[model samples]
Target: MYSSVDTIWTLLGAVLVFFMQAGFAMVETGFTRAKNAGNIIMKNLMDFSLGSLVYWILGFGLMFGATNGGFIGTPDFFVTGDYSSSIPSAALFIFQTVFCATAATIVSGAMAERTKFISYCIYSILLSAIIYPISGHWIWGGGWLSDLGFHDFAGSTAVHMVGGVSAFIGAKILGPRIGKYTKDGKVRAIPGHSLTLGALGVFILWFAWFGFNGGSTVSATGDDVLVSMASIFVTTNLAAAAAAVTTMIITWVRYKKPDVSMTLNGALGGLVAITAGCDAVSPVGAVLIGIISGFLLVASIEFIDKVLKVDDPVGAVGVHGVCGAAGTILTGVFAIDGGLLYGGGFSFLGVQILGVIAVIAWVAVTMTIVFSIINSTIGLRVSREEELAGLDIVEHGLESSYADFMPLISSEAATTTSTNDTNDTIPVKRVNSNPNAKMTKIVVITKQSKFERLKEALDKIGITGITVTQVLGCGMQKGNTEYYRGAPLETNLLPKVKVEIVVCKIPVSTVIDTVKKALYTGNIGDGKIFVYDVENVVKIRTGEEGYDALQDEAEAPSFA
Candidate 1:
C-alpha cells in the first residue's frame, strides 16, 4: 500500500492545484477588458464546480479504470464497486480532477470577451467529461501511447497541450473579437486591462506549480520519492526563472522596452515547458529548455497573431499548446537516461513526436465536432453589441472590474455672516455658504501611476474637491506602434488620467505646485495640468452658490 504520508502529500498537492483556479481567473481577467472580468471569474468557478461533478460521474472512470483495447477504460464509473486498494483512490481522484479543471479553464482566456456564457459552460462540460480525460488516458492511464514509451512526466501534453490546442480551435471557430481586425486584414492590438493583476496571477501560478509538477510523483514514500520531489521543485523553478529573464531580454532588444504581459506569459511558458522533463533533465538542461521556451513563446505568439490572424487575447495557444509540444520533445533531448544527447538514439525523440502528433489529432478532431455542434445550436459567441458593451453587465449584471475607479466625495462647509442696523442693533445668522471664496478648476492630465501621489498632494494642501476620469489622448509621441503577437498596432490614443479639482478657498497656485510636484516624472508621458477659471458653482441640496457648492457639513453625521 502507498504510505499515508504519500496520500497526505498528494492531497496537499491537489489543494495547491485547485487554488490555481483563482490564478487562472486573475490572469485571464487581467489580460482582457474590465467589462468581461465577471464573466471570466464565473467561467473559472463553474469549470471546477461543474467539472468536478461531471468528472466524478464519468470522466475518472473512463480515464483510470481498466483499459479496453488500449484506447479507453471500462468500469469504475461513479467510483463505486470493488476497485484496487493499492493506492488512495480519493487522492488520485482529487489530483486528476484538478488537472482536468486546469485544462478546461485554459480555453476560457483565449475565447474570452466574445463567447456566450451558456456556450462556454457547455463546452467546459464537454472538455472535462470527455475531451481532456480521453486524451489524458492515452498517455497517463495505461493506454496505447503509454505502451509506445510516450513520456510526459507532468502533463505537458496531456493537460497544457490539450487545452491549448482546444483553445486554438475554439478561437478560430468563434472568429476574432470585434475590432480585432480591420477591412484590409490588418490585426489591431487590444491591450489588457491590468498588468498588476496579471503579474500577481503569474506569481501565484508560480507558487502553485511546485505542487503541479512535484505532486505528479503521486508518492512521498521512500528516499526515491523524496529525492524526485526535490528535483522536480528545483528544475521547475529554474526553468520559469530562466524563461522570464530570457523573455525580458528578448523583448527589450526587440521592442526597446520590457513587455510585462509577455514577460509574465514567458514565465508560464517556461513552467509549461519544464513540466514534461523536470524529473529527467539536469538544472542546466532545464534552464536551456526554459530559454528555448521563452524564445518560442515570443515567436509563436507573433506567428499565430500576424500570420494566422488568430485573436488570442492572452496568448494562451503560444504559452500552452506550442510550448507544451516543444517541452515534450525537449524531454527526449534532455533526459539523462534515454536522451539523444546521452547516446540513447532517436527512439525516445521519435516516440515523443509521435505521441504529440497523435494526441493533437485526437483533441483537434474531437473539439472540432464538439464546437461545431454547439455553434449550430445555442451559438458559440455573443452578439457584437454585447461584446462591445462587455460581458459583465450583459451576462452577469455586474459593474466593470474598475468600478472602484469612481471616487465618492463627502465634505461640508459652514458660512457665518453679520448685519449691522441703524439702531445699533446687530443681527447674526449661521448660514452654510462660502461667499468670498474664489473657485478654480484645475485639470491635471498625467500618467495613471501619478494619480495617487497627486491626490495625496492635493489633500495635504486642504484641497479635496476632486473628480477623476480615465481618458485616452496623445502628445508629442502621437502614440506608438505596439506589437501584439508580432502584429504592429498603431495606437494613436494612450491612456491617461484626467483629474478635475475645484478649490474654493485653497490657493490655485498651491494646487498647481502640488500637482506639478506629484506628476513631474522627467519622462515623455509625465502628463499636463490645465488650470481654468470657473465663473460660478451651485450646490444642489442647499441654495448655496460659488465656493459654497463645493463644501459640505464641517461636523460628522450623528445618528442620535
Candidate 2:
C-alpha cells in the first residue's frame, strides 16, 4: 500500500515537472524577438520529444541502474531485468525523464536565436543520453558523490548546474547575437518582446516548483515523510517570494526603476538556490538563502555578461549555474543535522564543495569536447545572414509572430530613412486650401503605448489617414541603464513611434491640438511633434493633387 501511494505521488510530481517545459517555451519566446518566436517554440518542443526518447532508451539506465565502481551504472540497460523489485520503476522513470529534459532545455535559451535547428536537436539527444544522466548517476544513483556524504536533496547540482554549465559553453561557442556589441566592444541592450508572457511563465514555474521540491521526498508513507514534504513546500515558496522582493528593491535603487524581467529571473534563482536544502532548512534559513540568491543573481548576470562576455539570452547561467553551486554549498551551512550554524563543523561544507567541483570538472571537460566536435563538423551556429534575417523565416520558413505588422526589416528601415524624400519629377498641383493653396505635414514622435489612443483621437477629430513607423531616439531622459549580470548598459536610443500625416483640407493647428490632447502625459519622454509646410501633394492612385489628394473616396475630411 505504501509503495502504491509513493508511486502515485511520484507520478503526480512528474506531470507537474513535465509542464515546466511549456513554461520554458513561453519564457524563451517572450524574451526574444517576435521574428524568432516560432523557431523558439519549435526548438523547445523538439528537445523534450527527443530527450524523452533518448532518456528512455539509455539515460534512465545510465542514471538509476545498478551502480558500478562508484562511477557509472552498469546494469538495467534498456530497463531490462529486475530493475524494480521494491518500487514502481515506471513512476521513477517518468519523474527522472522530465528532470533530464529540463537540464537539456536550459541550454536552448542561452544559445537561442543563433543556433542551427539540426545542431540543437543533436546536442539535445547527447545531453539527455549521456551528459546529464552520468552526472545524475554520481549524485542520485548511489555513486561517488552520494558515497561521500554530499547531499543535494533535490538536484541543484545534478540538474540545474549541469544545464547552466552547458549553457555557458554553448553561448560562448555560438558567440553573441548580431548587434549585441559594437566595434568598440560596447555592450548593447536587447529588450525582450513581451514582459507579460515572461512574467506568466515565471509564475507557472514557481507553481510547478512546489511539486519539484516537495515531490523529491519520493514517499508519502509515514508521518515524518508527510511533515517533510509540507515543510519543503513552505520553504520553497518563502525563498522564491523573498528573492523576488529583494531583486525588485535592489534594481529600483540601482536603476531608479524596478526591472520586471530581472525580478522574474530572481524568483527562479531563489527556487534554484533553495532546492538543495528545502527539506532540511527552517523557514528563516530559507528566507536568508533566498535573499542572498537574489543578490547573487543580479550581480552574476552583470559579471557574466560584462566580464565573461557570454551572451546568454535569458541569464540561464546566473540563475542556474552560479546560484545552483551556491545553493548546494549553502545547504551545508543551513542543514539541521550537520550544518555549521547548528554546531556540526566544516566537514559537510567541505564535502559539498568537493562534490560541486567534481561535477563542474566533469561536465566542463565533456561539454568542451562535445561542442568542439559539433562546432568543427556539422557547425554549431547559424550563418550571420540567417541570424540577421531571423531564424523563423530563414531556418523554419515561417512568417513573423505578429503577421498583421509589416516585416521587422521594414520598420527598422523606416527609422534610418529621411522624411524629406519627395518626387520632383511630377509637378506640384494644388486644388483646395487657403487662397495660397498651401499644405501642412504633421509628424508626431511618441511612445508606442500611446499609439492607439492617438489614433482614436485622430478618428474623433475626423482625420482619416496617417502613417506610423517604429523608431529609436533619445531625449530628456537621456536613455536608460539596462543591468545585465550586474553591469550597467546605457541605452541612448529608445524605441518610439513616428506618425506622419499630410493635410490640405484641415487646419494644421487643429491637427496638432488633437494629437497633443491624446499624447500629453507631463513626462520626460512625452515626445515631440513637428509641423512642416508642404508645397505639394499627389495621390498615387488617381494622380489627384493637393486637397483632392487628401480626400479619400471623394470625401473630404471634416475640419475643426
Candidate 3:
C-alpha cells in the first residue's frame, strides 16, 4: 500500500541530496585555482544534470529491475518497474537518481583543472548509465552480495567506494597537473584559493547528510522504522564529529599546527566511514569508526601525494575510496548483530571484506577501460596551452568566474590615446646638468604593512614621487618554516614591498634617517635600504634632463 508519510520523507530526502551538488561544486572550486573555478562549476552542474537524465532513461531500470543470475538487473528502460516499496515508484526513482549523480560527480574533484569539458561529459554519462548501475545491482538489487548478507546501509561501498575507485583510476591515467611535482620528485604545495568556500561546502554537506543516512529507512509509520532512522542520524553526526576532532589533533602533532583543509576532509571521511554501518553500529562504534577514518584520511593523503605521486587536489581518493573501503570492512566488526566482535564469528566479517574487494575490482577494471579508450580516442586531458590559460576562457569562453572582482579598464580612453597623432613632434628643450647635484637612488625593501607609514615619513623629508612594487623575498632569517596540507615548507619566502626613490636636491642622509624612523620595529624583519649612485634622470613628459627632471619648474627645492 502507498503511504503518504513515507512518500513525503523520500521526496524530502531527494531534495536534500540534490542540494549536495552545490556543496560539491563549492568544495571543488575552492580547493582549486581561481582560474579554473568556472570549469569546476560546469563539471559539477553538468554531471548532475546529464546524470539525472541518463539515470532516469536507463540507470534506474538496470539498478532496480528483476535480477538476472544475481549479477545484473533485467533492463526495465524508462523506469517501468514493480520493485516492492511503500513510496511511489517515482519518489524512489528521484531519490535514487540523486545518489547516482553524487557518485558521478565525485570524479570532478580528482580530475579537476586540466580535464577536457567534453571528455568529462562523456565520462559522466558512462558512469551514470552503466558503471554505477551494474555494481549497484549486485549490492542493492537482489544480487549475489545481498543474498550473502553484506551490509552497506547507505552505500559506503556501493556509492562512495565506487566513485572513489573510479577517481583513482581516472587520476592515475590523466597524470598530475603541470608543476605539481618537480623532476627531482620533490612535492610542491599548491594550496587552494579559498578556504571560506570550502568550509561553507562542508557545512552544507554535513547538514544534508542527515537526510542521506536517515532517508534510507524509507519509512515513518512503524516504531522500529522511526527508531532506526533516529539512530542513523545520531551515529552519522557522532562519527563526523569524532573524525574531525581526531584529524585536528593528528595534524597539530605532525604539522605543528591544525590544518583547516585536511581537518575538513577528516570530517568528510568520518561521514563516509559511518555511512556503511550507521544503522547497525552503536554511537560508541560510530565514534571509533570516525577516529579510524581521521587517521586513514591523513595517512592516505600523504601516501597518495608523496609515495604514489598522484595529484588529487581535493583528497577525493583518500576521503572517499580509502575511508569508504575501511568503513565497509569496519561495519563487519562493529555491527551489533552478525558482527565478528559480537560473537557472530568471522563469516559476516568475511562477507563484508569480499563485498569491498569485489566492488573495488569491478570499478577498477571498468574505469580503466573507460579512461584508456577515452585517452586513446577523443583525449581525456586538455592541451598544455589550454591548461596553462585555464579552462574557463579556452573551454567555456568565460573570461573569469570572479569577473566582477576585477578592475575595470576604460576602452574609450585607450582608443583615444591610440588614435592620437603620433607623427607630430613637439619642440624639446634640453636643460644643463647641475654638476654639484649628485643624484642618488634609494631602494627600500620593507614589510608590506609599513608602506603607508614609510610613505608619510618620506613625504615629510621632501622625498616624494616614490615607486612601490610588491615582491616576494627573504632576508638572512630565510623565513620561518610553515606547513601546507601537512607538507613542510622549509624555505618559505615572505612577501614585502620594494619602494624606489630618486633624489636630487634632498640630502641622502635625511631621507635614509626618515625611512629608518618609519620602518624600525627593532625586529629581525624591519627591512633594509640600499643606496645607489644614478648617472642621469630624464622626465618623459617634458624631456627634462638630470637635476631639471627631479624638480618642478615653478617650485623651489624643499631641502638643501
Most accurate candidate by lDDT: 3
lDDT of 1 by residue, 74-106 (tens): 746688844434357777898999999999999
lDDT (0-100) at residue 355 of candidate 3?
Answer: 98
**Worst window of 10 by summed lDDT in candidate 1:** 413-422
User: How far out, in Å, is residue 178 in model 2?
Assistant: 2.1
Quote the lDDT for 439 in model 1: 67
- TM-score of every model? 0.85, 0.87, 0.86
Superposition-based RMSD of candidate 2 using all C-alpha atoms, in angstroms: 6.0
List residue ranges in candidate 1 displaced over 4 A. Answer: 81-86, 401-444, 449-470, 475-477, 480-490, 499-534, 537-560
Top candidate, metric TM-score: 2
Candidate 2 C-alpha lDDT tens digits along 465-491: 788899998786775456643445555
In candidate 2, position 188 carries an lDDT of: 75
- The positional error of residue 110 in candidate 2, measured at the CA in angstroms, is 1.1
Ranking of candidates on TM-score, top first: 2, 3, 1
The candidates, ranked best first by lDDT, are 3, 1, 2
- lDDT of residue 206 for candidate 2: 92
Candidate 3 lowest-lDDT run of ten: 418-427
